[model samples]
Each structure stands twice: as structure tokens, then as C-alpha cells.
Target: MPVWGWILIAVIVVIAVVAVIVARLVSSRQRTERLRGRFGPEYERTVGEVGNLDAAEDELAARERKREKLDIVSLPPEARAKYADSWRTVQIEFVDNPSSAVGAADRLVIQVMRERGYPIDDFDQRAADISVDHPKVVENYRRAHSIYLAQEQGDVGTEDQREAFVHYRALFEQLLETDENKDKPKETRA
Candidate 1:
């Protein structure tokens, strides 16, 4: 009730404020780390696109929530074999018509995505959804899509088209392999 009591109260309040601040900072840092690890390069891409960390984190979190609600399923063995055969046909066609081959590759990838239960209404949304489970190959999907866009504009060269096919193949292979691996025995998976 005197000078000493007032001073003690002020010190305690300051300590409590500092503790709260520190706790918030630590919590923020941990959230960032978790998002970074889960999203990988997609995290940086989102941050770059959104121009801020908080918004990017929010977007990534929203994608995670949306992904949780979706019923993404693996392809059946017959479907897998059919898609593989279609891909082989596309590759063979590439020798005669690179442009059409690239176009077919793009469509095939989207078809595979659709068959795997991904919504194919929007390219960006499709990429975001795929990033949730296929973070590593999502970039390849983006790059392939970009090339496809350039091809549509007649801005891509033969070499660029080839690169796009390669990128699409990367994503296609990942998608196919993931479906196959899901069906494999636990002991057979590495």
C-alpha cells in the first residue's frame, strides 16, 4: 500500500507483458516453421505471390483445410494401366507432332488428376490442391502448365515444348507412382 508495493506491482506487470510478447513470438515462429515444412517451395511461392508472410500462411492453411474436406482417391489398377498406356501413346506421337503431343500430355495430366479425384475446374486451384499431397511435383505441374500456356500463345519453341513435356511427365510419373505405391504392401514400400 506504499511506494514499495507500487514498484513491485509495476515490475510484475512489465514481466508479464514481456512474457506474453515472447510467447506470441515463439508461437508465430513455430507456425511459420510448420507451414514451411509442409508446403516446401509452395510456401515460398505463396509468400512471393501474396507479398507477405501472414497472408501466405493463411492461404496455405486454407488450402490444407480445403484438402481435408476433399475426397481424394487413388486410381484402380485397370485405370492405372490405361493411363500408362495412354501416356505411352502420347510419347510415341511426340516423334511426329511435338505440338499436338504436348497438348495431349497436358490433357492426359489433367485427366489423370480428374480421375484421381482432383477438381479440374481451375489450373491454379488444381495445382494448390495437388501441392497438399504432391508438394514435390506440384512445381513441375505449374511449369508444365506455363509451357502449355505459352504454346497456346505460339510463344514456345520446339525445345520449350520438349521441356514442357518433360515437366508434365515428371508430374504424371509422380501421380502414377503414388497411386501404385499406395496399393503396394507395406513391406514392399521403401
Candidate 2:
């Protein structure tokens, strides 16, 4: 080929390489934004735990994929009402037996989670899965679980137990709201 033709080919190749790099970068940035939006604080939490952005993103993506495969169904109206009533009873009982009330709150949260189609075989795994849909409340679930563990070891104080109940209530209220919202029409939903 002529010298000009060779130069032209070189310029074309460089342009193609630059374009590919830019496209890849854009795609990577978009993925990061999507994960951040979906996971909220949980995204930062995972990144902190994993110590790397890529690894944390992979872990979060895995959680998303795993959640997609699960049959997470909404609670029926009657079931939701029943669970809400049970939660109210637990709250009222807190006045008489704080420790037992906290324990019952913990169990009720798990029962609601299970009834809503979350797997309860493992606490950590369940929290991870719940984080995919309920990112904001996942931390409350973790805190509540930690308190429950402390209680099991007999190291928890009444104040800590009360705090645990509060954390559990945060997650429980979120779960209940999510279920109730699912039953509402999109135009009527808050």
C-alpha cells in the first residue's frame, strides 16, 4: 500500500481502539450506578466488607441473580392482616415481658419473611437476599439478628433487647408496607 494508505489504516485502528475503551468505561460506570441505586447503603456496606469495588459488585450481582431465581411471592390480604395483628400483640406484650417480647418480635420477623417467600435456612444468606429487595431495612435485620444472638448467649441487657425489638420493628414495618403496597394499584400507591 502507499504511505498515505498505511497512515490512514493506522488512524482507523487507533480510533476503533479508543472507541472500544470508551464504550467499556461507559458500560462499567452504568453498571456501578445501577448497583448503587438498587442497593443503596447496602452497596457501600458490601464494598466495605469485600474491600474492593469489583468484588462487591460481583457479590451484589450474585445476590440479585439468586433472588431472581427464588419464588418470592407477596402475602395474601388475610395473611398480612394476621401477621400485623400478631406484631401488635408482640408489641403490647413488651410491657410485661420485655425479653420475651423481643424474642417474639424476632421470631415474628422471621415468620413474616418466610411467609413472604424468603428462605430461612441461614440468617446471613437470608439477609443478603432480602437486601436485594429491601436494602434500607437489611441493616436493621442484621442488627436485630446480632441482638438475638447476644440474647441467646445471655449477654443481652433489657435495654439491648428493647433496641433489638425496635430494629426488628423497622424491618417488620417495611416488609408489611411492601406487601400492602403490592396489593394496591400503582396509581393509588404512595
TM-score for all models, in order of appearance: 0.88, 0.90
Off by over 4 Å in 2: 178-190
Candidate 1 runs further than 4 Å off: 178-190
Question: For residues 128-168, what per-residue lDDT tens digits would candidate 2 score against the true structure?
Answer: 98899888878878987898888888998888878788888
lDDT (10s digit) by residue, model 1, range 1-190 = 8999999999999999999999999999999999999888889999999999999999999999999999888788788889999999999888888889999999999998898888999999999998888776788789878998999999988888888888888778777765454322121100
Report how far residue 7 has shifted in candidate 1, in Å.
2.8
Please name the candidate that would achieve the greatest TM-score relative to the true structure.
2
Q: CA lDDT of each candidate?
A: 0.85, 0.85
